[model samples]
Target chain A: MRNLYLFFRKHYFIFLFLLLEVVSLIFFFRHNKFQNAVMYDWTSAISGRVNNTYNSIAEYLYLRRTNFILGEENAKLHARMPQAIYLADTQIYIRNDTIMQSEYRFINAKVISNTTNRRNNYMMINKGIMHGIEPHMGIIAGDKIVGQVVSVSRHFSWIMSVLHKEVKISAKFLKNNQLVSVEWHGGDYQIGVVKEIPKHLIVSAGDSIITSGNSEIFPEGILVGTIKQVKEHQDENFNTATICFLTDFNGLGYIEVVLDMFKEEKTNLKASFQEL
Target chain B: MTNLVSRNIVRFFFLILFQVLILNHINLGGYTNPYIYVYFILLLPFATPRWLLLILAFIMGLSIDLFSNTPGLNAAATVLMAFFRPFVIRAVSNIPEEELGIQPSMRILGFKWFLSYATILVLIHNFALFYLEIFRFAEFFQTLLRVILSAVFTLGLILLSELMFYGRSKK
Candidate 1:
């Protein structure tokens, strides 16, 4: 027993080092899978407050640019307003219709903190559980896809940006309706790669890629990027294309969290079907 | 001794804030991220107990990870760097017994000694960090490029900060 104590005393530092390293590695591997919500809430709450304070001070530096973008978006929205549209068929009376109901609700949130340099980048928004933001919901800037919410605190949420390697967005070519997956491969924040394109398809530069609405997260027709180049993959079957993201991730200021109204119902229906 | 402890405490928070708030935003070319926060680990007093050193390094790293939303990458790298720090110091310089408790700095140690020490530790930290971040050998060359570039930038910032302190102390 004394010999064992001496051994421990002599090699305690090594044991401690090993212990810490193992703990950290566990945290690393278990981060995305089965995230400890309480720990995340505690940490994010503190970081959220700090980032919120810092963002409030730094917001002034980009006011002009933000205003310009907002103005452009406002003009586009204004053009689509009923007041701006000329009615050619005045005989047909326009009435409130019960057939169509709102499918997606948009909640405006300011980005508190964002990073693009890392392989797995994340963005923090100034809205969370209290503000109706939840995990697995989509986020967008204007009509461009930004990311999906991964975790939420009381008043803050973390987003796994499209720049993340594991984030594969279901997208389709706007011209042909051909489906493809958009993924970031850990370099160049402004660019992503489109995969699963059959080699026979005629793909060209500048082809627009938009959300396919195959998943519950994003609605259809939201812009993702424009194709920059297409390269033949090692497999003889599919070709991959590089795309330029429309949303400038580095200068993201305001974003909207997409709350699909029927998401729960759809998921529940799918679950019931799978049970059979 | 109390004064030294308090100063280090102040430096610990100051470095974390400076790193997360300012340095993180400077994503030059989307490749070179200067992790000057590792300087805090480098500047700890030489006589700090091995267990305490490891704990402090872990806490510092975890704090940075929390802010950045990277759960464990920084913590692992910083702890490893801290574990290697004593051996690195012994290899780089022959310190007299009386100078055992002094902090490592360019002003106390010559610029050459400080540079090599900082370079090795920063490289080790960045090497572990960037590789573990990508978690693959597929992009080995690209990740290596990022590691070297980031390490150079981090070393430059550490030396500059040390020089700034050196100039103030001289006055």
Candidate 2:
């Protein structure tokens, strides 16, 4: 009607704003999960490539510090390898050949680009599909779980760093079998919050934290970090503690990507349960 | 005409690139994620059509949401901001409609008036953004804290940017 047109003309901006908001909400609700359409995927790929190019230029800036960490880690691994062989019949799991079959293999790669100062920090590594790196694989620096792989390209992959709010690393007490999760609180890059640790456990400062190995992505017994502080809730049933990570993600350069050979089979089996 | 259109085009591309590539990565602790993109909404020409301004704001914020995986929250907040900007400007500056051809800047509105305008709209944008992202009022206090902190940080950054980038155009 003429009146309807007149009303619309008078308040066109309001109607348009409302209409766009409704469309956005509809798209958001229908997808539920954030949709990574083909365009997004392509952009990520292009961005990763661009990031890798910049990483090469930045690598020379940290050669000295990176070398020191690598030397320390190599020495630690060499010392640990002998003790494991003496204790167990076979120290590690291997697919083939004479190489010691360790449950986890640490493939060294350099970080090309990284962001530690974001709500969701991500790091891009120099090695990727060509180097046998794949998505969902665990990443480590020193003895700590740095993060897990999220996306991969031919020559690069991005890590969802533990500094990110979205990252939830499985952790457990080395002294006891109790399991918990460590999540970043977006407060500090050096610290993360350990959640769901039952209050019944005798926890104290300097308590050791290790990977729970509950996720298919990471093997059991990997080092996470240690509890730096604990705030026990008098009435609440669980203890909220703060953990200090061993590896400085800001100092990231050379890292070891862990490839779990059983990953594909295990993921498929897990998917079967959801399908049923 | 061509020069004006080309200059606007170049500014738009640079603003978006600066937002996503550089400012997006800077997290100055707490819930304060610096949103320099709102500069676009704040700096839009006064003569720009209200509906078109709202649409452009929607696109700018939606593009950020798409890149950052934040769903509809940014778009919703930005459109809300665009909806309220004209009123905020009129209330603060009392510039007659005929003389509104000038763009928003310290020169046209004066430092005191422009600062008030920017602060108010930044608060509105951050309020809608942080609350919508949280999607619930259960943590009303925490959400309020985040909104206030982000607004302050964003205001500081916007003023710093104005000093650095627009310092020469002192009116």
Candidate 3:
């Protein structure tokens, strides 16, 4: 027994080193598999408070640029307002439109912390569960798709940025409405690759890409990016194209979390079909 | 002794904030991400207990991970760096018995000794961090490029901060 004790005492440092490394590796793999919400919440709570305090002071530095972008967005919104439009036909009556019910609600949030250099990047926003944010909700800045909410705490939420390797955004070309998925392959945050494009389709540079709205998360017609180049893929039947993202991910400050009101109903209906 | 403990406590928070707040935002050309937080592990006093060193390194790396939303990437790398630190110091510097407990810094250890020490450890930390982050050998050359570029930038910041902050102090 004493020999065993002496062995441990002699190589205690090695044991400790191995123990710590194992623990950290476990955390890494487990986090990748299924995020431990309890531990994530605890850490995010502390880091969120610090980032909030820092953002308050640092936000003033970008006041001019933020205001400029806000003004442009405001102008775009103002143009769509009912008050700004003048009907040419006097016989046309404007009544309560029941056919066009609001399906998506937008919750404004401030991005407290963000990154673009990492292979799998994430962003933290000021809004959380308290502010009507939930996992799987899409985030957009102005009209550009940003990312999806992966997890939420009481006062903060984590967003898996579109730059993440595993993130695949369902998008379609505006010209032909051909569906393709967009993905980031770990280089150049400003660009993303459009995959699964049919080889026969006529894809040219400068074609606009927008969300397909096939998914419950993001509504249709959200701007994704503009195509920059088309390259033949390894598969003969498909091709891939590179696109320059419209949203300036690096300069993201103010964003809106999209709350799909009928998401639960839609998912439930689909789940029923899958049971067969 | 109390002074050393308190000083490290202050440095712990300061370096974490500086790293996640300022250094993280500096993505020069999308290739270099200078992580200066490893300076905390690098600057730990030579006589620090082995267990304490590992624990401190873990906490520091985890704190950075929390802020960056990377759960364990930094923590694993920093622990590996801490594990290799004593050997790195032994190989680079021939310290006298009287100064065994002295903190590793440019002011005390001289620039050449500190440079090699910081470089090897920073490279180790960055290499582990970037590789684990990608978690694959598919983009080996690209990841290697990022590792080397980031290591050079991190080393520059470490040496610059050491010269600026500790250069004036005689102790």
Among these predicted structures, which one has the highest lDDT? 1
Candidate lDDT scores, in order, read 0.90, 0.75, 0.88
Please give, for residues B1-171, the per-residue lDDT of candidate 2 as tens digits. 465456556766677777766666566553356777888888877777898898888888777764554546678888888999988987887777666544677765567877999999998998888766556565578667767777888888788877676665532
- Clash counts per candidate, in order, are 0, 5, 0
- TM-score of each model, paired residue for residue: 0.96, 0.80, 0.93
Using TM-score as the measure, what is the rank order of every candidate, best first?
A: 1, 3, 2
Candidate 1's displacement at residue B108, Å, is 2.8
- Candidate 3 local accuracy as lDDT? 0.88
Q: lDDT per residue, candidate 3, A1-276, as tens digits?
A: 999999999999889988888888887877744442777778888999989988988899999999999899989999987677797775445455686668999999999998899888889999898888888899999999999998888899989999887799999999989999999887789989999999899899999999999988899999999999999866478999999999999899999999998998999999999998
Candidate 1 achieves a global lDDT of 0.90
Query: Candidate 2 local accuracy as lDDT?
Result: 0.75
Tens digits of per-residue lDDT, candidate 1, A1-276, equal 999999999999999999999999999988886343788888988999999999999999999999999999999999988778798786544554665677899999999999989989999999889988879999999999999999888889999999887899999999989999999887788889999998888999999999999889999999999999999877568899899999899999999999999998999999999999
Query: How well is each residue in B70-124 modelled by candidate 1, as lDDT tens digits?
Result: 8888999999999999889889888674764478877767888889999999999
Candidate 1's TM-score reads 0.96
Candidate 3 residue lDDT tens string, B75-134: 999999999998888898787746744688787778898899999999999999999988
Model 3 chain A: lowest-lDDT 10 consecutive positions: A90-99
Best TM-score among the predictions, by candidate number: 1
Candidate 3 residue runs with Cα over 4 Å from true position: A32-36, A86-98, B94-101, B165-171
